[model samples]
Target chain A: MTFRRDRVAALAVAALTAGLLAGCSDDEPDATPTGDGPSASATGTPSPSETAPVDRSREVVDGAAPLEEIGTTTGASGSSFRGATFTFYRLDASPTSTLLVWTMTGGGGSNPQDANYLSWELYPRMVVDDTEYRVLTYSRQGEDDTEVPGAVSNPVLRLTDGTESSPQSALFPPLPDDVDEVELKSPWFDNLTLPVSRPG
Target chain B: MRTAAATLAALALTATPTVAGATEAPPLPTVEDVPVLAQTWVGNVNDDRLAVLSVHGLRRIDGGTVLYYSMGTPQDALGDRATFSAYGNGNTYVFPQGTNTLCAAAAVDAEQGLAYGALAASTPTGCLSTGIVDFATTAEDPERAPVAHVVLAEVPDDVDVVDVFVASQLVQGVPVEDGPLEPTVEEAAPAVGTGWPSVDAAEVAEADDSRSVFDLQSRVKDLSEDVTTTQDGEQQELDLDASVLFATDEARLTSRARSVIADAAEQIEAAGTSGTITVTGHTDSNASDSYNLDLSQRRARAVGRALEQRLPDGITVRTEGKGEAEPIADNGTAEGRALNRRVTITLPS
Candidate 1:
């Protein structure tokens, strides 16, 4: 009776080993996260929606996570050198416009970085009805338009939604009706593709 | 003290007007109508006092009459954060680098009252120590002039400024002992030497130093008779809001933009085609650096192309797009944003 029970346990162990082997794939991202904070789970198929910028006018999914993994492919990620994860977080959106936000999380270095230390020239991009529109950033609220913070971070961007003397009234291009995709991009950070129009 | 003889000579000339307004007018020393140079002050303010390092020129404004100053500091000044404040000053004023009430000590060459504006630091609250910014009025008619200027109307006609000292500390002035009314053009020049009482070397070196801003009326005492004398060249920049020129993000010139280009083309032609005509397109800080740089360049090229068609054969037209790098106004406010989105067609004189 003891020998039979031992054989049965051995069989069970063999089955578990096969299952684990079947799940193993060469494409799997590494388990260890790189960089400062908000470590990425690093364990899922790369979402297709992250390939392109978000089209907020397209029916957005309800109760979706605000964050999306952005460019490692766009050549704008720290992940190329260090295994850092770059993400875009959508905070809000208007009918045709979306407020796109982003952060670079998990890089190699453990050195302390001031929130204001990081600086980049960032702005919004959108395509509507086959015509592309670029929004001119009014300011990081510069001294005048020319002088911006030499050092800064916490990059926030949005469409110049014209509302009573806001920069949108004059500087920003009007949002198009038949919008395709809205995006925020910077050379320093990766291109942020929002989670809009989820594929079936 | 250096201007004593010049002041008396001017007084004698104005007080005793001969039939001939002669002397062919000392030839109005070439005002240059343009800011010859600008300097920024490099010092920090501490314990309610700003240390006076060497002063640097901030640039010139108001028909070359008003000079602006920037005090340089490794540490930022209270009002220094407000960079837009410079464009907002309507009646030619100075932008004290980063200062507290330290520059508020006003002084006038009792001989010529306008001298007060040069050395003193006047705040938006009229240098009154009030938390509020913005003076009650434009002409320091009530508040004396702030920092230096090449040409300022603040100098009174009949008066001659012999000396300058802190206003409250000293009670005496160069007394006007019943002089003439309509001072000659030579007499009109206000004698307010660049007043830096602390450093005797700077005081002695005032003649050659660019930091030493002479009164504007005095600077223009001799014109070579060939200066076009227009305010267009008075400031280094001539910027036009982009909204008035192009469609949202499109670099293609709108009809309205074309019209503006035509008008500007005429101005360029009139200004003389001796130097290269640089057409630069600039955008506000709304987009990424790469994107902004590309768009602005494209827009500038478009304008340059159009101007090329209209320009005279020999005028060299160069177009460059300075993304969000070159801003002339504050981007914090709407009005400032509008000012930032611009296309400037610069014709070198």
Candidate 2:
């Protein structure tokens, strides 16, 4: 009986050791290249070639520049209620409507509902030639009678290390031809003067 | 065999990282740290729950003023759950300059999650009927006192301060700040939720087609067990309980009904101009519609005649019956059915 128990215990210990070694072996490939290991050169040579084909599936699609591009005008920033800063990135204008692309940053540690307040509740108006224009509603592409009014898209852009940013775009009524500058009236802030760069 | 077992156990222990000494998390900040323009404490006597409501500020958003307020519990308070229902729905109102009192279409809290807003898009009227803000203690951090943001939309512009009526107590001269309250470190990443539908411009345009913004008043008061009153700027409706006015299945007035009608007539005489007063009778979802209609019509006429006799000439009284229709409360409960069966006297503007 003593002999049989000793054999069983040895087998159990051997199995536990093997399991631990297997776990370590599974993580070796990832950690090897980062550490000063002798196998680093052997494994590093083939990694780029192996990953090249797999990376194609995740590459940006052809003709993707237009989809990511914003308006023609840029370089304007202003502050609004609750210490939120707005950096206008792009401004695209057509005959029927004007699109303003901007990023909202700051306002750290606020309630998430504050994002909703800034997006849907607050309407930013633009004044051109002393005529104030409101946000124009637009129907979703290919969906009739489903109008989405102009507002920020996301509810919250967490302020982490004061670097978090929320990208937003709002549509407004059309601007007249050769309009060089306009005043923006956001919530609590009466005037944010921005120069418009007309499309060539 | 014992040596082999001991070696395996030591190997297993070495594989896992050692835990550092356990340290307690820092405590959450108390509600006193928040900057508030106006605040009031409300207690629920039945549940022993106390809540603090503070108005932070008002900002002009999208041609309407957005009123921002915070609802929270003081540190060490007995009750952690704070909601708009605690102050009673329709009890809160904002009076802007020149515009009539604006009742909140809906009150939303961040803790309910974003599904509430997506759901509100489908049923606009149901969302408009009840405005609720519910805040409960989170399981992950029970020590953190629950605080929720409450917003009321469509307040008229240029009003610096307004009177807020909550829990039957009037708070006058509450200052309205020009901008929103400064963001606090403790409030970072409050849970995301759907906004009130009325704040959405598209939804507002759609709802406006069916119901006017001026018609969204819900100030109601119950004077006694048998009498209730609803008032807006333009109209006033007084409801008299049918059980107090008539016997079951009968249109004849009870002996005590005369004093009630007399009091209503006196109020009408004082408040009404030389205009037509409408006395409408409603019934709960009981008995046949035709039978209920006949009974209601008789009851309205009886009350109308009683009012006409008490008032001097010049006020015109019109009587109508809307049986089993236009129920103000749900008919799923006994109390709701009792409330539905009533005669309403609407004084003209």
Candidate 3:
């Protein structure tokens, strides 16, 4: 797999270099096309207005989609916490990762609660074969090459009429490939079994 | 042109995804016309190498908030290298849930007379991930404009917007769009601190055997370079350069060192009252251990006496010296040696 990817990358580079050489040979006086060597005019202060047009298209490539949506739970899978209703909407799985999506509906009665009022530490987890896999947290490399974890993405969800719902998702380590079923657990919801779907 | 060539060379390594007939890549969501919540420019506006960072998406996940922004140079041929570097090296300050005040991150060579002193100080935690959307050259389009680098940061929940301090410029009030933004990676873990429940590393290792486990440590520094303070929630250690405090190996405080010690006294007083301040002096591995220890002890005593006189009543000041035994930086280099030659005043929170 790695060899194939490398070959594709090499071919792409060759093609791009050839195209660049062909394009620059037409009008650029300073364009010194030496196969894959540096462009002579790269350091020249070319005005922004006189620069080339940008290609915004994202080309599709192969072997990129390593994960697929393999299974999901049926029916209204949700749990309530405080004054909010959290509904599990979707789940996408791969061999090494899982993406779980849900929605949080505000339950504004006399007392109202939104996303801001909730604690971010309350993460959902999945239990496969009695083994629990917690929702993964995001981390980045810090000073002195330390891995600093515990960064979260919390979008502001304001509840005006108590019916407003906001989409939420969490990524987790994957379940076993052959596992047919697993149980989902969250702070706001009870443990519920979800059947794994293997689509051809 | 060397930079452009280098960028293309680097891009070529990852450009395989652009090749056709490879396994089908996941379809990226169509670029939406998301409203820019906040925007700021890194580096001097007049500088040709300037980059613009604008917030476009913000969403809440189970345990944190994710912010998406576009960081890129506006002009063609000016690669996103500087912009990406600035963002990578920058720090994100978030107003954690229910708090209107921003916690200040310690900065190196921070501008004098900034409002950071007014805000409470805390180590900010967030993970920054960048994706190169487009890399264009002047040859591609006479305009040579490149696509902006897409940056996503996961911060603590309740962070509606964030103040990014990158390349010595603080861009504040960058509002987050309350919408969905796809993450570049599938699996991400929360930062170590910020009150999140701890995960079982053994269990996590079993699930994802390939995950790299890291030692988590939170060290927040003060804004000054000469006189810096590092805190880890429990204790705050203020390190004052011995060179600034004394002349060479001398134990006596210089006239300029008097003011520096005075400022540290004020900080110590402001931090709290009645806490025991342990003043420990360190030295580089230049001289013998005994000689260095004696010098460090004298230096610690001098700073301790100065602090004792300035601090309010009921506060105790103790002094000691480790003398090249506990060097924070490498002593082999001159810069590291200078860092090692310092007096540290530790105060418990």
**For model 2, how does the per-residue alpha-carbon lDDT over B1-349 read when each residue is reduced to its tens digit?**
1121122233234433322221211111222223334344333212223344444344433333334443433333423333323332111211111111113222111111000111112231122222322233343433232223322444443444543333312222344434323221122112211111113334433432121122212222333434555432345678898988999988999998998888787777777557788999988878888988888899999999988899878988999998876555435435446767899998876
Error of 1 at A19 (Å): 78
Predicted candidate 1 versus true structure: per-residue lDDT over B1-349, tens digit per residue: 1121222233234442322211111111111111112111111111111111111122122111122221211121122221111111011112111132222222223111123333322222222111212211122121111222122112333443222111111112222221111110111111111110111112222312222222210000001111111122122234555887788888988877676667667757776665687888888778788888999999999989988888887887899999878754435434346656878777674
Q: In order, what lDDT does every prediction score?
A: 0.31, 0.40, 0.40
lDDT of 3 at B207: 30
- All candidates: DockQ: 0.01, 0.01, 0.01
Q: Compared with the true structure, what per-residue lDDT tens digits does model 3 show for residues B78-110?
A: 532332322221112211211111111211111
Candidate 3: misplaced stretches above 4 Å? A1-200, B1-32, B37-54, B71-154, B158-160, B165-172, B176-179, B182-238, B252-263, B270-272, B288-294, B325-339
lDDT per residue for candidate 1 within A1-200, as digits (tens), equals 00111322332343343223223412221122112212221122122233422211111111111122222212243322133333332222223222333333334441111111112112334433233333222112233332332111111111111110000000112233333344544333455443322111
Error of 2 at B270 (Å): 2.0
TM-score quality measure for candidate 3: 0.37
The docking category that best describes candidate 1 is incorrect
Among all windows of 10 consecutive residues in model 3 chain B, the one with the lowest summed lDDT is: B107-116
Candidate 3: residue B185 Cα off by (Å)? 15
- The residue-level lDDT of candidate 2 at B201 comes to 33
